[model samples]
Target: MAETVFARTPRLVWRAGTPDDVEALYAIVSDFDVVRQTETWPWPADLSFTRSRCIVTASDQGASGVVCQGDEVVGYLGLSPEGKIGYMFGKFYWGRGLATEIGAAAVAYAFDRFDWQCLEACVFADNPASGRVLEKLGFEEGNACQGPCRARGGVYPIRTFRRPRA
Candidate 1:
């Protein structure tokens, strides 16, 4: 296994998450707008639940990551064993290259650590910024579909994107 590099991006550190990240993970999970557009995860997220997410992210094949700098967790990302790698940046941390930075690292991890065949993303149709992020990482867009997102407040369409493992 590649000794985790304390992987550096322009601003964030992509490292394996620990139990200590529960609180930081909760901040983003509690943000309906953040988790909703991303996954429709049941909302008004409680700290306990978010804590579990942090621990589980490391174990889940997809939809898991730790976005940190030094020691502060700024954002979180994940790549499911099933080919879904999702990401969410805190509202306070948006607009920086952090998303792309950690995202590329996560993709590298998937390829290097798991011998993953391919990874994919499902973006709510309205969220072009996310699609752009995936594009920057070399993901290609594919079939689109209407989808429901209870956490996002209602149903909406989502587009799918794919990145082949290198």
Candidate 2:
């Protein structure tokens, strides 16, 4: 809930996520392709409104925002409670530069609105696209490690990245 109007890209608007957005949010994150590389999304995707509500509520407390394309919620860009930055978009929006737009908006918000000196992100080793999004936002590559990917149902290689406040 830092600021409702987080940022604006050419085709997308970044705004804070709200409880009412659960349905639209669910549509994006529930897609197997979207959550496959993530750490928290459940595998086989529960596809339940209850789960999406919980996620929206939790994200609402931090710098979480919905990525909108002309009045439609297309994705999410947010900072976790632990200060890590993450995003998810509907598969239809992929490869169209939406992630980069949202990522840059989230990075600016973190540095300008919060006291944290640095922000971190972790991308699955197999997900080079996500890694590129972080890199475009100025996140420097760091150590690589193994982490539990809930959707994958096993440990997966992860690449860590960090960006310090300017």
Overall lDDT per candidate, in order of appearance: 0.76, 0.79
User: Over 4 Å off in model 1, which ranges?
Assistant: 1-6, 57-63
Task: Compose the digit string of candidate 2's lDDT tens values, residues 40-148.
Answer: 8785666564245334523333566688999898987778767799888889998999999878877887777777889999999999999998888899999999999
Residue-wise lDDT of candidate 1 within 20-130, one digit each (tens)?
787788877788778777664667786666776676535434446578877788887777778788788887887787888888877887777676788888899988889
**lDDT of model number 2:** 0.79
73 in model 1: Cα distance from truth in Å? 1.0
Candidate 2 stretches with Cα past 4 Å from truth are 1-3, 47-61
- Clash count of each predicted structure: 12, 0
